[model samples]
Target: MPRRCATRNDLMKPGYVYIMTNKNNTTLYVGVTSDLERRVKEHKSKKDPKSFTARYNLNKLVYHEAHQMIGDAIAREKQLKAGNRAKKMALIESINPEWQDLIIGDE
Candidate 1:
């Protein structure tokens, strides 16, 4: 069978940079994904029990930002990871002062 060509819509899928945290907000996990909902669900489900986020119980979707390109999202994720906890907390508080779980009503 002939391979299908890429469409504009396929190329425009958005990417996301998200932060997950434990209940106490002591641990922050920054990640980038093209499918934010699915990725968050996997983290909440402890899909990889041995992973750092899962091990630290960091399932709360505290903060997220959308990007038009995957590269931008990845770069933002890297910046967040390299920054200190104070910087990360400031970013989170700017959008989610209470650190409410963004996925709460989706289920």
Candidate 2:
């Protein structure tokens, strides 16, 4: 047997489509990223002070789904963004009835 090295293509990471909301759940944001944890942290930290998430204080990750590729995740994000608030809320409620902060593990 021989040792094999990993290539860029071999390091394909799963993409994520995630929803973030404020503490009061008055606002909702849908985004796609390859690194869910990092992206969530960025949201929490307000990496871009003037960004929509920062302005709305939408740091709590309420829902997320993983896809095989970034393109799939982006497509899903678009679909979610195009949807109405009621539909989006329904989608989130389907998995997270209480609309808990998924990143903090407070179910």
Model number with the top TM-score: 2
- Model 2 stretches with alpha carbons more than 4 Å out: 1-12, 105-107
Which regions of candidate 1 are displaced past 4 Å? Answer: 1-13, 105-107
Q: 1-107 in candidate 2: lDDT tens per residue?
A: 69676456634657899999999999999999889998999989988999999999998999999999777787899999999999999999999999999897322
Candidate 2: what lDDT? 0.89
- In model 1, what is the error at residue 105, expressed in angstroms? 6.5
Total backbone clashes of model 1?
A: 0
- Model 2, clash count? 0
Which candidate achieves the best lDDT against the true structure?
2
Model 1 scores what on Cα lDDT? 0.88
Instruction: Estimate, for each residue in 1-107, the C-alpha lDDT of model 1 and write its tens digit.
Output: 69686466655677899999999999999998889999999999888999998899998999999999777787788989999999999999999999999887332
Reference-based lDDT, each prediction: 0.88, 0.89
> What local lDDT score does residue 12 receive in model 2, on the 0 to 100 scale?
67
